[model samples]
Target: MVRAPFLFALLAAAPASFAQQATLSNGTMHVQEGTTLRFTGPLQFTIGPAGALINDGLIDLGTQAVVVEPVGSPISGSGVEMAVTATDGPFNATAPGGLGLSLTTNTATGPITVTRGHLARVFPEGDPSIARWFRLEAPGGGSAPVDVVLSYDATELNGLSGSAIGLYQSTQEDGPWSSLASTNDAAQYTVSATLPAPWDFITAFDQDAPTASASLVARNGVEVWPTLTHGPLFIQVKDGAALEELDLFDGLGRLVTPAMHQRSSTFASMDLSGLANGPYFLRIGQRTTIKLRKE
Candidate 1:
């Protein structure tokens, strides 16, 4: 009986293995995440391979530092901890950075992007001290992790020489874009890119030139080269859209549908059930050979 009492005591004193977790909710708040976390909100905590901890309104989570692990950097398994010490009270939150990850209650002006995990590349919208333009080539699809090509237009205006371009993606448009591969020559270059995955939109930003845009129209790829004639471009997705009157042409040089008939531009689907499954061309206005295929 005496041994049994002692055994129970030992069990009670044993160090506990915990999956550190916390929370901040309701009234006045305090939060810590990774290693750089400190908040005045009621909802904040951290997590890892282990589990998480829930924190009440006010609680000291010890002096252990929190960290921000790079989502796509060399520190794969490593964690970046941010330490917070409250000798008296919580630390004030600094205005969040604009690039990469952003944390703030800033009023929303427009769309918010959630990307730019790597810190290697960053650019200011109009930083005279830096190169600010780049381009992208997604040959295969519109998402990422697949094959894609990147090409740099020109960063500086006056010197305007083509530089290396690499593929990049960002969850947030306002943040940094991830780099993929570099395509050297502008028009002649062709590469494959795994699309960024079911994003409402994919934008190509260049650090050297004003802008460049490429899009898929009717199964055909169309790139609007950023030049004095038509630079700083954006791609518009047209799906069964209607225009006043527009011309359409088949793949062959011969005009299947002429500009004259394109007035009020009604394009009924050309019946392809009778044709073999193969590549066809589409001609629009001055543009020609928009490769279309039926399968």
Candidate 2:
């Protein structure tokens, strides 16, 4: 179906899905706040010139793609969005692969275009397994810091540890890849990173593990292992130090009572199977806080 000025304002508890290919040839398509517009099925969405997408709710593209022709009205507004899983291949104009990557812009000057490909980029630090490179741009070539959420599939890791993988950004496609301080969800197989500036390319790479000695000491002589843990979180004290008390806090700083935790003079293990997947803080007695992630 085609709507010149497609204004979708929904109030139902469930989201509405577009099962077939839809086209917004002209005017604007506004998704009102609190609603969800999900695109499903094996078809693509086309937004032509003079056509815009203003999302105030959720625009969920589940394994689907959108084609926003150049000079087309841009996708603007502060809202939630979801992307598709990337595939290895050339840039398919009908379905460019910015898979599992979502962007939130505070101030958008024009439409945003994201494309993913295997462009043979250089990673001087190391190589990425099953890497799918992504490129993002908008009208008039821009500049601004933006927060991005990117995801990966377990199968894509290709025998690499999920926690060891991180998002790497580069100014050019060929050389010098820098690691971003990323918040990795070991359980969910996703990573979140902030782009301090405009980047030419971004992809995920497996980072080298720290030396054994460095890994053995976290802070205040406390050792925390597998910052990204699936269930149990291991803690150890060094230099003949003893752990006084252990306190667990959620990402919001709210105290969380761990269902199972055992502590000795030098070692302890906390059961994280009961907690949700996300970031957390593990307090080792007084004056020390070690960050932990449960996936």
The prediction achieving the highest TM-score against the true structure is 2
Q: What is the lDDT of residue 37 in candidate 1?
A: 29
lDDT of 2 by residue, 176-291 (tens): 45556677787886776776556456777555532122133366576777676777778888768667688777654457887657778898877888998765656666645555
Best model number under lDDT: 2
Model 1 lDDT tens row, 1-295: 0111111111223223323323211222112233232333222232322222222222222333222212221111112212223222111221111111212222221222222121122322221211222122122222323223322212212233333232334444333333323343545432223433433212232333321223333322232111112112122224434432223222222234321311233332234344433323333333222333344
Which residue pairs show backbone clashes in model 2? Answer: 187-295
TM-score of each: 0.21, 0.41
TM-score of 2: 0.41
Cand. 1 TM to true fold? 0.21
What is residue 169's positional error in candidate 1, in angstroms?
9.4
Can you give the lDDT of residue 45 in candidate 2?
63
